[model samples]
Target: MEIIHHHNLAMKTEEEKLPPLIQAIAAREIAGFDNANNLHLHDLKISILDANEEQKQVSISMPSSPIEVHVGSSTLYPMSDSAAKFHSQPIPNNNKLKYQRFDSFKTWSGKLERQISNLRGKPCEIHENDDIENLPLDRFFDALEGPELDTLRASEEIILPENEKWPFLLRFPISTFGICLGVSSQAIMWKALATSDSTKFLHVTPEINLALWLVAAALVAAVSAVYSLKVIFYFEAVRREYFHPVRVNFFFAPLVAVVFLAIGAPPPVAGKLHSAAWYALMAPILCLEVKIYGQWMSGGQRRLSKVANPSNHLAVVGNFAGAVLGAAMGLKEGPVFFFAVGLAHYVVLFVTLYQRLPTNETLPKELHPVFFLFVAAPSTAAVAWTEIRDSFDHGSRIAYFIALFLYFSLAVRVNFFRGFRFSLAWWAYTFPMTGAAVATMKYADAVPGAGTRLLAVTLCGVATVAVAALLVATVVHACVLKDLFPNDMAIAISGKRPKMTRKWRHRYRRRSSSSSSTTDSDYCQGN
Candidate 1:
């Protein structure tokens, strides 16, 4: 590229020596020529007239077909006009430029002229004789004819592309079963509160318990239907979820919800349905337990210590829930067997989490609510032991006290549970609180007193308020915000990290700087 500086100006190699306006115009012209020709042939020349000249012009010349530019008071004109006549015409100074070019140099030269005019704060104009078919917009649409146009029309008919067009049922996650688990546990807590002698003065009624059970049952049915469809239509997705370390724990939730429903069944249905449901559900629970628990002990990729998190408590708690239901239905030996299996694993899992083992999985702050499961497991075990022995015995008392201690241990760390945005993980708070409330009620029965009764009522009230707040927040999040179904399939199918939103990205950065133990992959698995 050669630049000719006029008015006795010295030839300088540095582009910075040119005036700012000329420099910008020259740079844009060079870029346009390079893109259009896709070659490095340096045959372009730019002529810059002295600023003091009466008719200062910046003319760009190309080897193939040259075009000249005349700059006059922020307006551009074609080279065909004479210098004297160009100034004589009364042209509107709307800062618009008009030019004509040959077919060979039409694309790049026209773009260069428009950009130069714009650099001088002016618009580019097309002459009346210019073909409308050669306009940029018309050319773009012309290229999209035939198959491309038909594909565009078909896409416009649908809301999303073919790959992303998933039915609502396919979007439902197994973790959503946690909602049914929470509601069912709440129903059982209400039933226990109504039946206890020491809390009789609170005037809790059977009707309230029954109503809560019905709501829980409806939720279970809906969730079950959606998940069943997922299993049939997207069985691969189901398989992926089953293999996830954190997500696999929630697969036990639906069974636990069904067990709670059976335990909390009204007096009329409790007799016939309780025995039948216990027998039917027990087989599947034991089969899953054998597979999962065997893997935990046998030493492989699925070792317990490797995947241990507070969420794993879900699997342990299911066994206790089954034991409680089994004992309630007057099964003597089966409940004891399930209780022993659950208690053995509970001790190991609890200690692993407490020690914060180096190999154990770490959850992000958003999932810290599952830490409350520490309180749930022991509390459910306490209730199971009480039902098995037909009384809140000394052994049951010890378990209840452990649960009470853990509840206060977690409750005092207010910051650990606050500041997290609403998610399905918030459902983690509901069942654990309800479990503690039921344990406290049983404790109150063992030692009747005003203080004991007050403690039970307070825990029950807190559990009730937590569940109600979660329900409202979930409705607003899913309906108003439209963020409930993020379709975070990366973790399961692709082994890629879920994309973080702006708020979560900020939080992740802040937490990352403060702590180095957790990594980006851990955050993906936790969510």
Candidate 2:
């Protein structure tokens, strides 16, 4: 190859310049060369390219395109030696001439490093997953997409993505209580269909029995999946326990226990053992609920302002759930105690949440689960009242009527969820619908009239369909889209609790900080 040199620019005589031996040493000292053959061709090309812009234009279109060169508003191409010069006329700095290389090589090498590193993962795009709605799968599929399968196999530790600095895994919302609520709802339906003597459920043929068992199996599978998520939520995210308002969801544990107890064990399993297991679990959950409610009540009327949406009804639902299970277990006083506490607090919360408009921006309308609470509390109360009072009396009638009214109100406004993104909050629809159905069945059995029976059948069918839709949506979003949780890692990591202020301000600040601090949302978009 032809070489470029600054021989003509030399001010010294031939003898004044060092011999080849000394030059080799100088090259080694300046650029760390290992041999006389070693050359800084890239630096030479850049310096040469800088020497004369007019000359670079000629180089751009030539055969020397083997080596890439970048020029202003031009493509990268190789340059000839003729386009290079080791030393040129003085460079201008601060509008004055300064003859210097100015350590520009470091800057050039650093830029190259950045460009090269960026190229590695850009070319291979992950193929888009198939549309979930088209897939034929069961609800068990919902648990398939959490944390990578490879990561789980490789290590027991949860290796969160870089942006997941939050203390919890994905599914960390208080609305997750709805998962247990959903299981309980299904379990309640199963119990009603298999055991109720009403005309609506009289066709308990072999096929119906098999279908009910299938529903039971689905309930069991769903509970296990949701419980695994809970372990990730509570155990891995130990610090999040301090997120006080969300603590209300802990009631879901007891509610789950109630469902299991209500279902009882199969023929082979000892019923007493099953009862003991549920009792063991519910005992702590009940105590914890007491402590948590005490803390909130201690805060008094001022704390009432911090109450979340209708989802807060899980607090009352928990007590009602416990009451149902307790009454089944023959614990008379416990059921009545739980029923009284649940009913009183729920009424207070209902009035409070009803008067308070949804002013928080942190909860987008699409993701909001609070409205379902309207149906949930009264329906749960009615079910609990039947179990506690041993009949669907006037009190149960009142609770069922109230829930029916709320259910119709929300049903008329079902368009709200159309614009909403799929979230764990959607599970909110399941349990409440089931609660209403269970309440309706109890009402039907008591009244034994055509109108009551028809309403009971209608409610049962609607609840079944609603729960089925929610289960399918959950499977699609959780298993297919892998979008069970929003990217709230930043808020969780910030560990910033909201001060008792206007709900909107607190919510706005939370969302702003979350978006600014992380790219967690981008991961969801990619999936």
Candidate 3:
């Protein structure tokens, strides 16, 4: 072993230049060192499954091959004297830290984390998992057959790899940045890349323009995330007072669903149906509201009336905000489709906003004010797009439809999740709908562009596998609906609780009118 130090970029030092003291630190993963996911803490002897080009050519690879590495503990693998010394130090106990049983290598570490963490009975499974542990060098090398192998040599210096990169410590920064213009840049980034403009020439402003696109994408990604967070927070905040009757109840869920249906809705019959599909959006909102707010109607009227829930009111604000944002983003880049997509979304929001009807046909002061302002968000979003649609390209329009689905589906249930918990069946279908939207944008006869139309397809495929893995796990008590508000569900549909059961009616008729209330209360004590 030998050692060499350099002060300039062009300098080189081979492994032979390091002394044994330094060489000891450079050996491939040593037993008891960190593993890929930081899930387990243990050490194992290495066996080469593959090697990188540089490693294949080298007499010895960095973190000398065939050495054991630790899993739960931190250790230096560079073999540098400084790193070796760094690895040898002992770490203190952290009661708060828990780890999963990491297999040490896999493409979907998040799933692995979820599985293992569940096995260990926890959510997040890392304590102090910061360590440059090495995997079997050969296996690691064999995996990187593309430019992604070294694509981010410089970026990885500070940022670790997500599934977006190799190894799984890095996460797609959804939380770090917030939404700005509308829709996250990830969707917009795909739109931009797929829709190449003649203006994007190589000799002209390629570098400058490309940089702008990337920066713009990062900003949008941040914005979309923030928008999601904001919507969910608002929903949760508004629902604080009412936790019964599944009050909010999928306020915007069906909207994502309609985006997919839009593809199939292209036929003349389909067009009329999809165009008029606003009825589907009206059901849940109108039903829930009639139950919640329209309780005072007379017998005949109550039978026909309904009430709206508190959280849905808030969702009206959040989801419509998203629709506006989505349409706005597509406005400049797309045309007819953006407006059409937005109009479709506005229908959903409008339905949700005024979902309730009075049982007795009597007007409530709150309904007009809440529904009016609530309707404003989607209305403004819709009109904005309709007015600007001519300037937007068809590609933007298609993307806008997909954007509508993603925004409406992702966070709607968090506030109103009851019977419709994390439904894999829902996501499985929704994902493909999103993909179809990307395709519609890609092939919509507007500007020509290439897109990862297959990205969402691939995701849909993955989701299929995931659904199989999904378990019917329910934590919240289903009885909350009955226990908290026994009449809510019935009220939503019938505009009133079902007429007292036949037996109760018969018994009440036989009882004295004066004691009717007391006798009925005793008869249905639990309810």
In TM-score terms, which candidate is top? Answer: 1
Model 3 misses residue 361 by how many Å?
40
TM-score of 3: 0.22
Report the C-alpha lDDT of model 2 over 427-472, residue by residue, as the tens digit. Answer: 7777788788878888888888888778777887887787778778
Flag clash pairs in model 1: none
Better of 2 and 3 by lDDT: 2
Superior candidate under TM-score, 1 versus 2: 1
State every prediction's TM-score relative to the real structure: 0.64, 0.61, 0.22
TM-score of 1: 0.64
Task: State the lDDT of candidate 1 residue by residue for 313-417, as single tens digits.
Answer: 888998899999999988988999999999999999999889884343345566778789899899999999999999999989988999999999889877667
lDDT pick, better of 1 and 2:
1
Error (Å) of candidate 2 at residue 446 is 0.7
Model 1 lDDT on a 0 to 1 scale: 0.70
Angstrom error at residue 511, model 3: 48
Report, for every candidate in turn, its global Cα lDDT versus the true structure: 0.70, 0.54, 0.31
